[model samples]
Target: MKFTLFSLCRRYPIWVAVLLLYAVASLVSPAMLNPDQVLNIVRVTAFLGMVATGQTIVLLTGGIDLSVAGVVTLVNILSTGLMLGDNGNIFVAMLACVAVAAIVGVTNGVLVAYFRIAPIIATLAMNSILFGVALVYTGGAPHGAAAPAFNTIAQGDILGFPASGVCWLVLSIAVAMLMRKTVFGRWIYAVGANARAAAMMGVPVRLVVVAAYTLSSMLAMCGGLLVTAYIGNPSLGIGNSFMMTSVVAVVVGGTALSGGVGGVVTTIAGALFITELNSFTNIAQASTGAQFVIQGVLIAASVVVYRLLARRPRA
Candidate 1:
């Protein structure tokens, strides 16, 4: 019984951390327990959650997508610019955003999978290129407004629940199912676990890697669109925060940095934890610097905890 408990804890440490965090937060700010406040936290978490879902997939394939931050910003600018607050333009704007995102994803994938470029360097370079493009297009000042219908995606609620939250939950379930139930999902895990071995087993390693990167970029774009809608305006550097938070959420959710060990479901908990942490800090009037420090410490601590748990022998 003890061993079973330990194993369960080892496998799902993120859930444990989340419970502890909520308990402590409730103690510090009892108002945090309110249903309205809790729902608000879920609503805000949807954006980060979407980005981190893609990050989780990339990480599972033993890669990183630093370009996700850039994808977010670019999509925000492109979507709103094309939409120009006109509802009729929404379809065209969104289609353009997805096309650009797919191109970016495919490029990153080709660089890393086909050309053997390091994932970090390749994605980082793509990020820089994207930022440059955004800068050139926006002329240092992005201008546009999200249409009322577009804004409803993030700003409206359904049956007293946040629409964004509902969307995220539905999407996450679909992704989780895809990863668990499909042959492609198995290929992803196989490749992440051992690329050479996967290739030997006829796993089409290159294709899997490319698909992972493509999905990452596409999801990052989705997240960016949601953020654009919520704010109803395009803003430069709007996605800068996701660069750190997405990876942090993935790591804290018990996903192995070395890859092949985590999934989108746990990332959901991780996103919630991160959003709650930020909300609590804001309520406590913590400085931006302090918040960074807290997040940094949390990441380090989670890494160590997971490593220790993973290293422990099963009884």
Candidate 2:
């Protein structure tokens, strides 16, 4: 039992640390331990955590999806703009948003998988297109309120915990289990490790790549719903910062940018660490600019440290 728990700890130090921090915060300030406060933090983390999980999966398969923020923003608008007044419109609107996200994902995959375009450049261009499409759809101003049911996922708790938090936790566990205990999971790591080698070994690298992007799109759409509700309305550029934040969380959670080295559990920790930092900063009355400066420095320093630590001395 001890060894089992030790292994789990080693495999999920980031999450362990986050939980530890939560415990400490609660002890230090009892208010932080209150159900409402704790639930609020978990609820807020869901959108970021859900989006970051998709990013983690894509990165694990040796790719990045820069269009996530734009996809999310666009979907938020779709949900609000189309479904705000009619309950009957919600389902169709959601399908349309998801369909759009899938099309974008497929486009990204096609460019990177077959055209041999760099994933970064391909996704970046896609991001531009998605942003433009969103701008055109909204005409420079976004209007629409998220439906109450949609908001409930982020706000309503079951016996004390937000439903979105539960959703995130369950989804993370499922994804982690899928990655660690399934054949597709193995294929993902293999592709991330070496696409050419994976092909040589009979892995369907191209299909895997495309499928990863599709999954990413799905996750982004889910996050968009949560974000729209979390903020209470659709606004222009509300999801603008998510792309960077998702990448930062993935990296800070100990996932290798080059791929195949981390899990969703760690990304959750990275999200909490960031959210906690933000909360602490707000508590300290720090400016938004100051927060960004500190966060940027931390990200840069972390990358350097990762590079140094990940290096091997010349043999």
User: Model 1's lDDT to the true fold?
Assistant: 0.91
The alpha-carbon lDDT assigned to residue 192 of candidate 1 equals 89
Off by over 4 Å in 2: 1-11, 19-30, 300-315
lDDT of 1 at 134: 95
Q: What's the distance in Å from true for residue 119, model 1?
A: 0.6
- Highest-scoring model, lDDT: 1
Candidate 2: TM-score? 0.89
Screening candidate 1 with a backbone cut-off below 3 angstroms (N, C-alpha, C), the clashing residue pairs are none
**What root-mean-square deviation over C-alphas does model 2 reach?**
3.4
The 10 consecutive residues of candidate 1 with the worst lDDT sum are 1-10
lDDT of 1 by residue, 59-90 (tens): 99999999999999999999989999999999
Model 1 C-alpha RMSD vs. true structure (Å) is 1.5
